[model samples]
Target chain A: DAGVTQSPTHLIKTRGQQVTLRCSPKSGHDTVSWYQQALGQGPQFIFQYYEEEERQRGNFPDRFSGHQFPNYSSELNVNALLLGDSALYLCASSFGVIRLGQFFGPGTRLTVL
Target chain B: AQTVTQSQPEMSVQEAETVTLSCTYDTSESDYYLFWYKQPPSRQMILVIRQEAYKQQNATENRFSVNFQKAAKSFSLKISDSQLGDAAMYFCAYRRRNAGGTSYGKLTFGQGTILTVHP
Candidate 1:
């Protein structure tokens, strides 16, 4: 009955560098989605992965990519990061694509210098 | 495109009292879902309550309830007998019911409101 879990609670990277954040979805869940929450702001959807394939994406650029493993875990990779990229990266999991209400993780705080 | 808005940036209420947080969203889709998520200082996003567009009855969870107005496109959360633990960042989000393919499971969130429960 574990909830969604994320790794690297906090990270710091310089501009132009790349970073990868990980997430383990809740038990019995198969869909994973990533979101970026900037300071004093709500989370913005990044992308969603289902069945080891990307099923949906937000308005994010190509630099932001993600992958879903067979086990339903996910990784969010941000390449050539900028200072504005610093934010709390959250992961949410649901039973399937049709379930809009998701369970979210504690999130990874990323600081791009 | 769907958009959520929480006009109030911050609000405070005394402990054991009641408080209401406002949330409004813009969407062209007739059928969808609206959600209220509570993010505590620990930064964990917890779902408070949700309402379906097609449901006329408001959604309620324990002391938390929503005032959903489909025509007005408004969804407000009311917390009764609030406690210190109720202090957190409240976010309003929306999702289209007919979403499929690359749009499935995506949520559009509002700017958020910071609720402070005074003890």
Candidate 2:
């Protein structure tokens, strides 16, 4: 089975511009979560989506938003990006009810200029 | 609020030797989950081992094992017979139990521990 898959492996955007990153959850998984990993640091939770609805969010601002589609694919959109937003955006997937181990994807590297 | 901390920013061990990386977390809840993830230069997060808070026995996987001290809220990873492939950045993460039935599966991660296995 394919693990979590993310698109646009690397991206470069200007400050104030918006970008949307995509993620396909692991096969048979329903819950999707996004994390931001800055250089030399571990990933920080951004938000989680379940049943097409956001279930929990971290300390991120309104600029960080996400969507979960019917196919278990998800998108992370950041509005008015800032230089601080440049980081490795990782998407992890797991089953909501079973409390299974998380499967992570190769993250999207976002660089805001 | 929950927080995870990895005191060792970087550690090194010779091949075939043993190394331990320390991690500590703060949380009031008694039931939870702890995880150790390895990220290489490829940047893909890979699960190494996990320990359930309620279990007193340490979790072990082949050459990788964890020392879980629930009372002290300390979780340390010990890699025996280390190999060159073991060189990577290790992350310790925590997740609270879904007490309210809203299981979002959110994870709070510590800074990280960089491990270098010298061959």
Candidate 3:
């Protein structure tokens, strides 16, 4: 009964560099979604992965991409990052696509210099 | 475009007291869901309570309850007998109902209200 887990509790990167954050969804869950929470702000939706393919995306640019493995784990990659990219990256998992309630992970704090 | 707003940026209540955090949203879609998530200092987002737009009865979880007004587009969370553990950043989020096709599960969130429970 493990909840959603994310790797690299914290990361530091410079502008124009790329970084990848990992997440393992809770057991019995198949859908994974990513979000970004800036300081003093709520999380903004990044994208969602289902069945190894991207199902939906938010207002993010092409630099932000994600992948879902067969085991339902996910990776969020940000390329050519900017200082504004520094934020808390959160991963959420749910049982299905239609499910509204999602279990969130502890999140990876990314710092872009 | 859907938008959620939490006017109260910070609030405090004495321990064992009651406090209500306000949230309002604007959406054209009639069917949707609203949620209240609690993020503690540890930064883990915990679901506090949720309400379905179609359900007239308010959703309640233990000491946490929501006052959902569909017409007014308001969703407020009321915490009774608040505890020190209740001190956290409370976020209000909204999601549209999945009719068909690709379900993104996208959630639009508000600015969040930081609740402080004074002991």
**Model 1 CA lDDT for position B114:** 96
Pairwise TM-score winner, candidates 1 and 3? 3
Interface RMSD for all numbered candidates? 2.8, 2.0, 2.3
| Backbone clashes (count) for model 2 | 0
Residue lDDT tens for model 3, A1-113:
89999999999999999999999999998889999999999999999998999988999999999999999999999999999999999999987544358889999999999
Docking quality tier of model 3:
medium
First chain TM-score for all predictions: 0.95, 0.97, 0.96
Which of the two candidates, 1 or 2, achieves a greater TM-score against the reference? 2
Candidate 3 lDDT over residue span B1-119, tens digit each: 99999999999999999999999999999999899999999999999898988899999899999999999999999999999999999999999988862345788999999999999
- lDDT tens digits by residue: candidate 1, A21-43: 99999998888999999998989
Instruction: List runs of model 2 lying over 4 Å from the truth.
Output: A97-99, B100-103
lDDT of 1 by residue, B11-32 (tens): 9999999999999999899988
> Each prediction's TM-score against the native?
0.96, 0.97, 0.97
Tens-digit per-residue lDDT, B5-94, candidate 2: 999999999999999999999999988889999999999999999887878999999999999999899999999999999999999999
Top candidate when judged by lDDT against the true structure: 3
Off by over 4 Å in 1: A97-100, B99-103
